[model samples]
Target: MSLFTEAFMTALLVGAIAAGIPLLLAGLGEQLSEKAGVLNIGIEGMMLSGAYFGFLIAWKTDSALLGFLGGIGGGMIVAALMALLCVRLGLNQIVIGIALTLGAEGATALLHHVQFSQSYPRLSAPMVFSIPGLSQIPVLGTAFFSREPIVYLSLALVGVFAYLYRRTYWGIALQAAGDKPAALDSAGVNVMLIRSGAVLLTGGLVGLGGAFMAIVGAGIFVPFMTSGQGFIGIVLAMLARGQPIWVLGGAILFGACLSLTTALQVAGVDIPTDVIQMLPFAAVMLVLVFLGRKANLPSALGAAYVRGAR
Candidate 1:
């Protein structure tokens, strides 16, 4: 069999998207959170919650839409904790974030043990849409033109967020909340509200990513299934600076690297499993470090905003 057969190549491309979309969503959400001056380390927990709840809802309701809603709800639940402690009460963001993540992990694990241990269920294939003419073309068609609707939506979000950042009042408020909360306050804008909103939005987006993972990527929810993808998403967000387009690029590239790792293994390359697995993270960091060194982050990216304190 030829290595470059249509089926094999298409599988690689499909795997790349499946692997990357979750990162894309999480990275974008993280970028937004950082823009609002909150480093949300609890996002890993948020993703796990989304995955479990999303899978459960999809399994019970037999509706992908409901699954996504459940995921969004799960993410928001954790986000509220972050907002309450960090944004509203002016606590240590890092400590609160870590606590939230640990709590989510234990909670999800316990819930999974109680509910899904005996009957581990899986979903059928999600709906795949093909662009009428583009899907008829050769290799590129299968890779991109023919994909699940979520793939297209994920790509579209890059453009949507780009527009939001460049030309929107809410986006400006978020920037001001991160860069100059005092000035935003002087201008009568509610910094806390802005930060809280950004965190909630981050949770929703990350939750959607988790749902995508369970319902489309893996078709099942297992404990600790997120596997540090949320942390990787943080790395991607930092590397991309504030550019949604960069996040999209970084996600796709990372996914491609993952596919490469699998391909190397399939081709029987004699490499250590540990080293081979590190390829995706290593390659992404190295490439983004060189390419995104010019990133200028917000001034108060991790500082709490205290009103009227000089």
Candidate 2:
């Protein structure tokens, strides 16, 4: 390969990893929530809210860590609203999530304009910590070790959830709650608590994704900065059918598409930026169609699990 082509390839790989982190994080969290039988369509809203709050906190405190944590808190707050609507009030999950997204967007837009004046500069982000000798490897090292600490966090979360869902008692219990809340309720698992916990955890991780975008990825807060990454994440969750490993695979593919677009643009390719921007969404539509009915979503998805429901 030409030196230019090699450089482009390397850049593409790096960019894909960076772009994939947000989706991977969001997907992993949503996977947990969905495994507990809750469909959180509010990921976009939570991410946006987190983005705004994270940027503001990071900018004001001059602490990237604070900002990142603030983002997680913001997502948790939005998830709390989702919990109130879907879990507490027994509202339609789809409507509740869509509405929350709209509300979050509006709120963040206002906050960005009023509080930050829409120009929150990027705080100095935390550095990626390599895994000692592992960081010295070749292409593999760059792929895994050269990323930000949160990148590792995102990957670790996948493993954590995978083990939690597939091997552990809590994982089995959560999945049982999702599949049949009555069974769990009868088993004294406190279905509501488990589901609510999952939702809160989902929000926190999604918020972290947003914070990464603002502090590490974008380095500045812009209106709608999340740019539908949250939505893509939801689609990824659906595609993976709540499997962490599958979700990571899907995220990497989507991230590759996103990275390709970015790399092409930076390389001054002839393609229109608009078309490149649409690749992620287009890929989503294609993947959704490809999965079709084969995607075995949770039986109780989008339903409020009440005790003793047959």
Candidate 3:
């Protein structure tokens, strides 16, 4: 029998959704932070920290749900440090962000070595939540309807965000906080608080993405297991250009392209391994480069906000 089949395509599609979830969550978080005018380069660190803590907790307790919480906590811990340095003390954003990523990488590796070097631990298969009627629809059923609960939640979040952005005071505050902090400050909204909250929330979402990876995507933890999904997420956020719906679409597209690339390699396409690996990255970049030229990020992005400064 030939390698190509409906089942093979279905498996690839399934893998794509699994890979895309992390990117979508992280991208959404990044977009939120950007909307509040904080360029969050520490997202990679946040994700890595989540993966480590989530994996560790899950391994110890055998509860993926708790592992998710642990991951969120880990991300929040990093976010707090970020807030203290950049938002509170007004440190340089890029410098602090890089430091955070490097710190998390080293710290997580050390912890992993100490705890699981001798005997690597892995989680058992996760329990998935399948939609009843929708799940019975052949190819579409398993690919889109039958999935982990988080997958459905993540998809639903796009609509929720859309509603928030279009019809809520908090969303407007987030937009104002990003576009004109001084204006927001004059309007009696606390600029620093908004930025801090955005960062912390970003950390939580990104961390959840990482935890999902370890608990569901990989089922194991390794040093730097996040690879570059966090960064890819940043790209997706930028490409989405302040639209949550676009973020969702971009993430799934990237994931699908990545899946297709992997399928090509598996089917014995004559591409180099390194080049094949580059498919997802290149595809996302190329598409976004053209479409995102008109993308207007916040003017105040990456700048530390100081009250009453000229």
Off by over 4 Å in 3: 1-4, 261-272, 288-292
Tens digit per residue, CA lDDT, model 1, 29-95: 9999999999889899889888888988988999888998899899889999999899989899999
Q: What TM-score would each prediction reach against the true structure?
A: 0.94, 0.91, 0.94
The RMSD (Cα, Å) of candidate 2 is: 2.3
How many residue pairs clash in all the candidates, one count each? Answer: 0, 0, 0
Name the 10 consecutive residues with the lowest summed lDDT in model 3.
264-273
lDDT of 3 by residue, 1-310 (tens): 5666667667667868988898898999899889999889999999999999989888889988889899998888898899889888989999998899999999999999998988888898678999889999876788889898878888888898888888999999999988889999999999999999999999999998899899989999999999888888898898888999999888887787667666665555555557656777787677768764767999899988989997
For candidate 2, the 10 contiguous residues with the lowest summed lDDT are 1-10
Candidate 1's TM-score: 0.94
Per-model lDDT: 0.88, 0.83, 0.87
Which residue pairs in candidate 2 have backbone atoms (N, alpha carbon, C) closer than 3 angstroms, thus clashing?
Answer: none
Candidate 2 has an lDDT of 0.83
Candidate 2 error regions (>4 Å): 1-4, 131-133, 136-140, 265-268, 278-293
Model 1: worst 10 consecutive residues (lDDT sum): 261-270
